[model samples]
Target chain A: MFEVRIHSRGGQGGVTAARLLALAAVRDGKYATAFPFYGAERRGAPVVSFVRIDDAPIRISSQIKKPDLVIVLDPSVMDVVDVLQGLKPGGRVLLNARERRDMKGYPTFTVDLTGIALREKLEVAGSPILNTPVLGALAKMGIVTMESAKSAITEMFSDPRNVSAAEAAYRELVA
Target chain B: MLTVATGNKAVAAAVKEAAPAVVAAYPITPQTEIVEQIAEYVSSGELKSQYIPVESEHSAMAACIGASVTGARTFTATSSHGLHYMHEMVNWAAGARLPIVMANVNRALGPGWNIWAEHTDAFQERDSGWLQVYVGSVQEAFDAVLMAFCIAEDERVLLPVMVNLDGFLLSHTMQPLEIEKAGDFIPPLHLPHAIDPQNPCGYGTLTGPDDYFRLRWDIERSMRDAVDVIRGTQERFARRFGRKYGMVDEYRCDDAEVVIVAAGTLGREAEVAVDLLRDEGTRAGSMRIRWFRPFPRLDLSGRDVVVIDRDYSFGFGGVLAKSIAATEGARPFSVIAGLGGQEVTYEDIAGFVRNRQPGRELWFGVNGDV
Candidate 1:
């Protein structure tokens, strides 16, 4: 089973990102489940969501303590939350940053999802939609096929910018 | 079509397929998504139903009963406080023998104010003459809702049905769901005693003391007869949709010496615990009680049982644990856990099996065994 933990602020669509990833995995002919860690969430409060993908139907519903991959949608949340706290030994980290950062020993992947969302003009109210663009980085990391990722995005969203933002992130991701 | 969706959306999807004539609901946390999705379907012309955004949950159920008596297929959804607020109408719907299907997102009753998964809310309605079915997955949620309409409307069992899904745990969780087109699986409702509003017939007439007990006994008689109806509906659903279900879902229990019994998602998680215990040479199994009201007869005579209850009765014992003891005569190790959505992992479930103490109660997360 491949478990993923996503960290982002409450209003940044972190939960939707988990759902999209799980949906993409399902489209790839695998079983998946996604859920959010409900807390006293507000606009800027740090929040977490989880996704589990496996060949068989996923049964475990508890929060993923040790995730195989950790994706940080907001690099600023890294200051308050330990994005690497319960990461497995061989786990990988994907960050929404313009440049790569040292993660001691873990393999880190960088993708400027915020820049891609803005470049594609994928803003909701006034914030760049990081959730859709992050799926492109996940696809680039071979977590899911680019085809399934785009399909999942279009299945839930109608705007063309969401797909463009994901495609841009898929090309710019430094894995 | 096979797709990924939350348990809430899955229920809404099934309701859409059933195409009820009326959907009257008031939204609440964890349960709001279900009514929202159904409302959207109605507004989008995908589902032709009278969607009533009721003022309160009481009015929600009341409107359903009002429409149901006039032979209209009705549906509604609610949660913890919303469910309690509609308590009177809940019993009225069942006592009146209205086949109104409801999806209740099970949540903890608040004193400190919490909105997470717990079975206490549904347990409170155990004897309301409603056939209760607790589901573990998004797919089961959809299937249960569809089958609920069939089971409730059967001539032999005209009782209401409540499909309970754990709040947040199942309601908010998204999983792969194969949406079945319930075309003709649920036949047209032919309510035997439906009142025609145009004729102006009096309904809910006062029951005199002489015949009150008989009326109550009739409810029980129909409740007992519902078992067969439920079985037939499930069997037909399986043959048509290719997915089968039963009153109890057993995992690895064929040759096991120890069994863990639970309901809802805890029941699904127990399967993983069974696998973990098997590696250590312990023959542990899991029996998930899907049907709560008109409870299925359990077969755990020789096995040592470990029962996990996500609900408590306060001053008594765990509702599930005590029910098993009363019916099966097995003194199970009652482990009270997951109240207000405290995380209960499969590892913890395996430990409960490892440390089996019959005839004892353990309040998990609190100190010792009582």
Candidate 2:
């Protein structure tokens, strides 16, 4: 099983990112489950969601303690939360950043998801939509096929810009 | 359609397919999504049902009972405090032999005010004559709701059924689901005692002691009959939808010396624990009890039992552990865990089995008390 934990603020669509990733995994013919760790969260409060993908039917319902991958949708949340608290030894990290930062030793991938969303004009309210674009980064990292990821995004969202933003992130990601 | 959905959404989808005539519900946290989705379906003209947004859970159930007695298929959903608030109407729906189907998102009842996953809310309703089935996954939640209507409306068992899913844990969890057309699987409800305006019969009035005693007996008799009804409905459902369900979901129990017994999501997680113990050569198995009201006959006479109960009976003990002891006549190591959505992982479950002490109870995270 491949387990992932996503860190972001409450209203930043971290939960939806987890759902879209799981849906893409399902579309790729694997079993997947996604859920948010709901707390007394309001907008901008650091929140997390989990996703699990496996070859067989996923039976366990407990929260992931040691994730194989950790995704940071908002770099600001790293100040309040330890995104890599229970990451497995030599686990990978995916961050939504304009430029890469030095990590201890883990292989890190970076994507300017916010910049891509803004470029594609996928802003909701005032925040650039990071969740949809982040899927492209995940797909580029081989977490899912680009076709499956784009299909998953289109299945949930009718807006064509969400798909375009993902395509932009896929091309601009720095692995 | 193959898609990913939350447990609440799956229940709403099944309810929509069942095409209930009336859906009277009051929104409660965790369970609110189900009513919200159903109301959207009603508004979008996808589901043709009278959606009643009531003031309280009591009114929600009362409205369902009123509509159900009029031979209209009725549905409702509620959670912890909301379920307790409708305690009167819940029993009334069952006692009146109304085939009302309800989806209960099991949540913790509170003085501390929690909205997390727990089974005590539905556990307390065990004797209300409502057939209860706790689902472990989003797909099971969908399938159980579809089956609940058929089993409840069966002429042999004209009683309400409550399909339960753990709040937040299962209710909010998104999983791959295959939605099927429930075409003719749930035969149109034929309520024999439906209120007829032409005949104009009186019901629910004061009854004499003798008839009241018989009425109570009738509920019990039908309760016994429900076991067969549940089995037949499940069998037919499997034939139609290609998914089968049993009274208890067993995993690696065939050649095990010790078995962990549980219900709801905890029960599903136990399977992983069983696999871990087996890797260490401990011969562990899991039996997830699905039906709670007409409790199934478990075959645990020769195995050492480790029963995990998410709900406690306060002064008595863990309800599930006591139930296993009473029915199977075997002493079990009772573990009380996961109350108010305390995280009980597969590793913790495996540890419980490794430190098993028979005829004893251990409360996880509450040190020093056995």
lDDT of 2 at B304: 90
Score residue B60 of candidate 1 by CA lDDT.
Answer: 100
**Residue B36, candidate 2: alpha-carbon lDDT:** 99
Candidate 1 CAPRI level:
high
Question: For residues B1-370, could you state the per-residue lDDT of candidate 1 as single tens digits?
Answer: 9999999999999999999999999999989999999999999999999999999999999999999998999999999999999999999999899999999999999997999999999999998999999999999999999999999999999999999999999999999999998889999999988888889955668999878889899999999999999999999999998888999999999999999999999999999999999999999999999999989888998999999999999999999999999999999999999999999999999999999899999989886589
- Residue A95 in candidate 1, Cα distance off native in Å: 0.6
In candidate 1, list every pair of residues with a backbone clash.
none
lDDT of 2 by residue, B103-156 (tens): 999999997899998899999999999999999999999999999999999999
Ten contiguous residues minimizing lDDT sum, candidate 2 chain A: A98-107
- CA displacement after TM-score superposition, residue B365 of candidate 1 (Å): 0.8
Task: Give the Cα error of residue B208 in candidate 2, in Å.
Answer: 1.3
Q: Give the CAPRI class of candidate 2.
A: high
Q: In model 2, which runs have C-alpha deviations exceeding 4 angstroms?
A: B198-201
Give the alpha carbon lDDT tens digit for every residue of A149-172 in model 1: 999999999998999889999999
